[model samples]
Every structure is written in C-alpha cells, then in structure tokens.
Target: MYIITVEYVIDPGHMLTFMDAVLENAETSLHKEQGCVQFDVSQSHDNPTQFFLYEQFVDEVAFQQHVESEHYLTFSQKVQPAVVSKSVRHWYSC
Candidate 1:
C-alpha cells in the first residue's frame, strides 16, 4: 500500500469551511474510489488551525488517479484560499 500524509495549516477564520471541504474529499475517496484503502482526517489538539490527512491507496497509480478525480479537484479549489501552509509525505507499506 502507498500512504500519503498531508499537514495543513488553515486560516483560523476559515476552519469550518476548510473542514467541510476536506471531509467531503475524504468521504468521496473512501466511498467512491475503488483504489482508496483508507482516508482519515484529524485535527491537532494543541492547534485548532492544524489538520492532518492520512490517505492510503493500493499503489502510486491509485494516488495519481485520486489527484485527477473531480472530487479532489473541487476540494483543492475550495480549500486553496483557506490554507496558510501545507506539507506532504509519501510512504510505502513494508
């Protein structure tokens, strides 16, 4: 499996809207995408503006397909203005 971890620093005032968009993205991935193994969204206890997304796919191609999906594109557009910073990491299961 291939895993992607994304850290997002959202604008404090836009937290609710950002959460909505990201939640939709996660839901769509898990429910609609055949290649998606798992999708998890988490909020930092110490930082209200911080969010983490853990996504697991069958392989790298699955991840690429996810990026090309319409739901993800919409989510990206919706949350772009609300994000202050973002970081991503990739890993392969042993």
Candidate 2:
C-alpha cells in the first residue's frame, strides 16, 4: 500500500469550516476512487486547531489520481486559506 500522512495546523477561527470540508473530501474520495483503500481524519487531543489525515492507496499512481480528483481539488482550495501550517509524508508497506 502507498500511505500518506498529513498534519495540519488550522486557524482557530476556521476550525469548523475546515473540518466540514475535510470530512466531505474523505467521504467523497473513499466512495469515488477505486484505488483509495482507507482515509482517516484525526484531531489532536490537546489542540483543537491541529488535525491529521491518514490515507492508503493501492500504489503511487492511485495516490496521484487522488490528488487530481475533483473532490481533493475543491477541498484544497476550501482549506488552503485556513491553514496555518501543514506537513505531509509518504510511505510504503513492508
């Protein structure tokens, strides 16, 4: 599996909006993409503005498809302005 993990720090004022957009994106990706294996969203216990995403795909091509997906593009545009900081990492199953 090709795995992707993301950590995000969002503006406090935009927390609710960001959550809604992200959740929708997750749901849409899982339902619409054949290569999308798993999508998980997490919030930090200590910080309400902190969020994380765990995504698994069949391969690198699958991951690429996801980034180009309409839902992802919409989600990116919706949340970009609200993001304070972001980090992403990729991995493969052993």
Candidate 3:
C-alpha cells in the first residue's frame, strides 16, 4: 500500500471549523474513491491545535487520484487559511 502521513498545526481560532471540514473530507474520500484503503484522523493529546492524518492507498496512482479528488481539493482550499504549519511524508508497504 502507498501510505501518507500528514501533520498539521492549526490556528486555534479555527479548530472547530477545521475539524468539521477534515472529518467530512475523510468520510467522502472513503466512500467515493475506490483506491482509498484507509483514512484516519488523529489529534494531539497534549495540544488540541495539532492534528495528524494517516492514509493508505492501493498504489501511487491511487494516492495521486486522492490528491486530485474533489473532496480533497475542497478540503485543502477550505483549511489552507487555518493552517499554521504542515508536514507530509510518504511510504509504501514492504
């Protein structure tokens, strides 16, 4: 599987809005994309403004499709302003 991990530090003022948009994006991706295998969202225990996403796709093409998806685009645009800092990493199953 192609794996993607994303970490975000969100602006505190936009936490609730960011949460809603992210959850909706996750749900939509899982339901709409055949290549999306897993999509997990996590929040830091110590810092409510920090969030993480763990995503798995069938292959690199699948992961590409995910980034091009409408839901993802919407999520990205919607949350861009609310993000303080972000990091993304990619991997593949052995």
Q: Give TM-scores for every candidate, taking all chains together and pairing residue i with residue i.
A: 0.98, 0.98, 0.98
User: So what's the TM-score on candidate 3?
Assistant: 0.98
Better of 1 and 2 by lDDT: 2
What is each predicted model's overall lDDT from 0 to 1?
Answer: 0.96, 0.97, 0.96
Query: Whole-model lDDT for model 1 versus the true structure?
Result: 0.96
lDDT of 3 by residue, 1-94 (tens): 9999999999999999899999999999899999998999999999999999999999999999999988899999999999999999999899
Superposition error at 78 for model 2 (Å): 0.5
lDDT (Cα, tens digit) per residue for candidate 2, span 17-92: 9999999999999999999999999999999899999999999999999999989999999999899999999999
lDDT of 1 by residue, 2-36 (tens): 99999999999899999999999999999999999
Predicted structure with the largest lDDT when compared to the true one:
2
User: How many residue pairs clash (N, CA or C atoms closer than 3 angstroms) in each of the candidate models, in the order given?
Assistant: 0, 0, 0
Q: Model 1, 21: alpha-carbon shift in Å?
A: 0.5
